[model samples]
Target: MLTTIVVIFLIVYLGMILGGLPFLQLDRTGVALLGAIALIGVGALSLEEAVAAVHLPTVILLFSFMVVSAQMRLGGFYDWVTHKLAALALGPAGLLGVLIVVVAALSAVFSNDIVCLAVAPVLIDACQKRRLAPTPYLLALACSANIGSAATLIGNPQNMLIGQTLGLSFDGYFLDAILPVSVGLLACWGLIAWQTRGRWTDGAALVPPAALHEARTEAIAFDAWQTTKGLAVAGALLVAFLVAPWPREHMALIGAGLLLMSRKLHSRKMLGLVDWELLILFMSLFVVNHALQRTGVTAHAIALLAAAGVHLDQLGSLFGVTFVLSNIVSNVPAVMLLLPLAHHPMAGTLLALVSTLAGNLLIVGSIANIIVVDAAARRHIDIDWRGYARVGVPVTVVTLAIAGIYLALRLHLATG
Candidate 1:
């Protein structure tokens, strides 16, 4: 039974690393869900035990924010932001910088994958209309979104799980992440801009003004009142979550409730946009990881590491292992696997930063990357692995180094 569980778990997670089973229609979410069912069918995890494995707080928190982000999307908030950026009239370099900052800020507050989903197509069209090469801005959008999502406890699913499990304060975690995130955003801008420097002018000829004007004509129709209301509630909820003593999940739930009260936007439409598959993925991983723990493999591995004097609290090994594991299984699952042994003084900060930054290493390293890539592909704009690696490699290196140095400084100051 243990071996059956182990084999199924490995197959499922390996599918995750490859983004799907070989030549199979299943995606990461589907693979994980199937793995959970197999464990149940094999009697490795009883129904009650499976239920116990799921961390409801994390799920609730994630669902609530999805509602918030969906409200913003239905309100045309993301479209409005994209249109405003298109109208900036900046040159190639300046526009790249603007794209980096705007995408990063939005992703930090919202789901990076959703942000890319909503913004990438519009961004590509905008750049193509302006005769600006869309590749650089597209890369910037993908990479910066990943980097910025590392900045806050709720920025991404993994961070949400880490925060809840570790009881890390929202504001405290934000403070620790702010410097690394800011520097990482800046580094992303510089790296992408440098990579695309002269290519901007060498691309297609100027897009006629008429074409540019026509492209902006379909800029998503916005309901001004709805947009304002969503932004206000989201803002207030954010402040309350940071400042008030209430648990963040409860606070976000309240905020989501307020959004649903609107008469202008149908509650059903907003609710439908939530990524239920991702929530399922988290729940499934929880069960699988719990089963693995039951098999005593994790305990044995920990004992081996401990005997070799390897602990997550140590700066170099922690960062190194985090980088490798995150890119290996992707960040959320990797964080879940490592969270049990993350007992270092700054483990919370380290796990959040390292796992998040590690996503920038490969096209498959993060969902945000896949979101942007797939979105672009749908538009017939191909952003291949090599093209992404051009920016991802440097961005990962520089930003990770900054994160490590910043965490070490924090540890030094706290210890001193």
Candidate 2:
């Protein structure tokens, strides 16, 4: 049973690294779900045990935000915002700066993946319409979104998991994270602006103005009423997270319920935008990781590493491992595997910041990067791995260094 569980765990994480089982057509989510099912089938864990391994608070919090973001998408709020940003009388460099700030701000609140998915296509069309090369702006969007999501616990899935599991204070995390996140956004803007110093126009928008009318975004018109309603709920949820001692998940769930009662938007559309696959991935990883923990291998491995001077409970080790694992198996799964060792003084903050920021290392590092790449491809703008790494590598190095410095200072001051 132990061997079987180990093999399943290895295979599932391999799928995570490769993004799927080779030639099997199964994605990371499928691989994780199958691994859980295999564990149950082999009696490594009972049905009840498998069910209990799931962290419901994280799921509820993630789901509720998905609903809120969906409401924004349905109301065409993202598209509307992108249009407004593009319509500004700014030059390429100026536009990139504004875009970095705006995307980061929105992603800090609405989740980076949702921001990327909803904004990328529209952003591409906007750039093409302006005859600006979409690559730099696209890179900025991806990088800034990842950095910005590190600002708050509710900004990304892994952060939500860490916060709920560790019982982290939402407002407290925000106050600490704002500095690094801001530094990251600034670094993103600077690096991309420097990289694309000369080639800012694509000449693709040379097409007629009338042809440009067919923007790449969905036809969902902006509904001020729906947008205002969603924003109100999001604002209220933010305040509750800041002040109320309530369970963050329950408060978010209540907000989601209120959004579902909309007369203008149907329940189906609102619910449809929720990322069920991501939720399933989270649940599946929880079970697989729990099963592995039961085998005592994780503890044994940690002991071996500690003997070799690799203590993950220390901030430096935690930061380095998260930076590596997040790119390898992706951030969510990486966070799941390392959660047990998150006992350092600043482990929560370190885990959240490094895991999220390191996603900019490669295109496969984060779903937001992939979404942006795919959107650019649809518009005949190619952002290959080399293209992304050009911007991503520097952005990552600068942001991580800034965050490390800040956290180390905080730790030093607190301990002293």
Candidate 3:
């Protein structure tokens, strides 16, 4: 039984690293779901146990936010905002700085993945219109989004999971995180601006492919009423998360309900934008990890580490491991695996910050990065790993250092 569980765990994670199995059409989410099914089929977990293994609060909250984000997308708010930001009469460096700031702030409230998906295409068009190279700005969009999402508990999936599972105070986490996140955003803008110093536009800048945009029909007219409604709900939700004592999942669902009762936007359109695959990935990993935990393997592994004087519950050890594992199995699964060892005084904050920040290290590290890259590709703009790493490597290292120092200071203050 133990051998079977270990094999399944290894295969699922292997799939995560390779993005899919050889000769198979499965992605990370499919691989995880298959592992969960294998466990249940092997009687490692019963049907009831599998259902209970899924964390409903995290899933519910994630789904609710998807609905809210969908409303914003369908209302054309992201499109309107990106166009306005890109159209500002500023130099390349100044423009990149502005884009970085706005994208980060927007991502902190909505899911960073969704923020990238909705904003990427619009950003590409905007940059092309201004004869600017879309690559650097797109990289900044992904980098800053990852960094900014660490500022709040509800910013990204991994943060939301850490917050919900650890019972972290929403307002408290924000206060602990805002400083590092802010500095990280500044560093991101500076790095990208420096890297693309002289090459802001292409030689063919004056000639935009009118034929390319002529066939594009993705324009959604800005709906003032819908945009206003979505903004009001998002603002209210943030205030409640900060001050109210109610369960966050319940409050978020209430807000989603309000948005869904819209007169112009149909329920079908709103639901269509939800990333059900991501939710499945979350639930499936929960079941797979729970089954593994029940086998005592997790305890045995921890014992071996402790004996080696490498306790993961320590802030420094966990911080380093989170960076390595996050880029390995991706942040969501990495967080699920390390969550069992989150026992340090500030473990929740460290986990949330490190896991989210580590994503900027590589394109495949986060869904947000993938979304932006794919968007650029459709426009015939290639942003390969090397293209991304020129900026990503430095930005990631700088941001992580900033976060580590801030947390260390907080620890010192409390202990002293």
- The best candidate by lDDT is 2
Q: For residues 169-274, what per-residue lDDT tens digits would candidate 3 score against the true structure?
A: 9989999999999989998988888888899985325324653573156656789999999999999999999889999999999999999997789999999999
Candidate 3 off by > 4 Å? 203-211
Give the per-residue lDDT of model 2 (tens digit) for 286-392. 99999999999999999999999999899989999999999999999999999989887579999999999999999999999999998777666778999899888
Local distance difference test, each candidate: 0.86, 0.91, 0.90
Give the lowest summed-lDDT range of ten residues in model 3: 202-211
lDDT (10s digit) by residue, model 1, range 78-184: 88898789899788888888888888888888999889988886887777768787778888888989888998988899999999999998888888999999998
Worst 10 residues of 2 by lDDT: 208-217
Clashing pairs in 1: none
Clashes of each: 0, 0, 0
Candidate 2 clashes: the total is: 0
